[model samples]
Target: MISTAIHCGACGARMEPGANYCSNCATGRDDPNTRALFVVDGTTGLFNDAFTGALVDHETSRAMRYKRPISVLVAMLDHSEFIANDHGPAQSADLLRELAEVLAGAVRDIDTVGYLGDRFCMVLPETDQAGAMVAADKVMHAVAAHQYAAGHGQWERITLSLGLATVNPDRMGRQDLIQSATLALMDGRSDGSNKVHLVSQMS
Candidate 1:
């Protein structure tokens, strides 16, 4: 029996696990359409408050609520830089699919993948920042190993940058989660290639 409670994102009211409706706003407990926000810069997407909310909703509905803190990892693939001098989206379908496969292999069956524009998001349920880093390292290694199909009948090896941050109900909302990840990703891109940035962790 869980005793902790979270606030209704739509309305500032306390909500407990198994809550199907917001007592203050009368909003449906789990709104699937209220999705997580992603700031995609090329192939990178930052998970924010919207994403956290959705996870909370889904987990509560299914009765598999996450008791431990969790984090979000955002990775983007730059189109122009992906094929160096080719001004287009990354078109290495085989390589991208392979990378995704490799990453999926590393995660638990409960975790899920989402398409946020050109970027992809991996929802790490019940995972903390450190655990996410391990998964990110696996993904980075797998992606770095790929020989992507560059434009104009050429092959190229690409790189990736990642941002990681944990979800905190008190200190953040859905949008804040996205913002933290985005800021971390931007900082990483500025720092150098093939780096993972850990922005925040539950205290």
Candidate 2:
């Protein structure tokens, strides 16, 4: 008969036969695949789309269960596509990385920051619409104030268009919240980027 016993992938502890995870180290047997589920974006070291969606789902459920306010912020670089077209993908990606760093610095430690494609998303737990607006304003100001180091000793300025959506008495799904924020972001872009739009104010 073939042996089924294996070692823990994380701690190298011996695992019992037919075990799904290690008893001694508590490491999962299928950790390689499991870890892939939470992989970060290689460029920015932020949560990728799959992980971001999962996080949003988890946070939304928690907020609904606990009656806590949760806010989602979606931010896009102003004229990012234009930048890519004019400056090339390398410069555009560098700008994204710099902006990601600024965003990571702007939010509270409790907040979750992730990337949804080229756009940035932040999930703020226990935050209402007002609080989210404040956070959004801070991020906008920070990005506006930051000077990115362009190539050849030249500096460049970057701006963000942000959208914020908060949980309310009417329950909303994770995707719905994201969509609302996206719509608000689009509105901000239409009004000219470097602005923050609140979904609550849209209606």
Candidate 3:
């Protein structure tokens, strides 16, 4: 009989054994085989230069090593499209960072946000599809009302393409998890902008 004793990362309290997750703080059971949820694959020098480097270190060293199932939120800023059409890059970049920071504040400290290629990856630990949706909404809302202060001589607004997906180690591996979420993002973006589409996978 494998007794899985769940424990909260925030506070050392014995969680209800075999619980879906830690009810108190949503800490998931420690399993060495669950897939990762977050996938941010973006180009360099968009959000921050250190984003991708930091992401790789964290994923390989901490996330993958622990075997915790991951949930991912990807935010892609189409600056090139805007620039080609004679739009402001500075204003757009600022808005993107603001949205990313908002998402960072919304998740638990244990969770991580990293750069994957040109996109930003939000690693949600033990969070399900529903919870990820709520978190994504928080970011969307935060970005929506964020004014770029027109009087400050700024273009003052930017659009984003976002997607959400969860990684279940019991079902997927590293490459597959990334592929699943990436496909979802593409599908969502194909539909329209400013959308948060949930991946068709178990959260």
Best by lDDT: 2
Candidate 3 residues 90-148, lDDT tens each?
54454445556655666676566655545766666666567778877876666655664
lDDT ranking from best candidate downward: 2, 1, 3
TM-score of 3: 0.56
Task: Report lDDT per candidate.
Answer: 0.56, 0.76, 0.55
Error of 2 at 180 (Å): 1.3
lDDT of 1 by residue, 20-127 (tens): 654333345577235223321223222223443465445433322334555667777644254534534445544455455555665566565543444455667567
Using TM-score as the measure, what is the rank order of every candidate, best first?
2, 1, 3
Best by TM-score: 2
Q: What C-alpha RMSD separates each model from the true structure? A: 9.1, 7.7, 9.7
- Model 3 poorest 10 in a row by lDDT: 35-44
Assess every candidate by TM-score. Answer: 0.57, 0.76, 0.56
**Local error of candidate 2 at residue 149 (angstroms):** 1.0
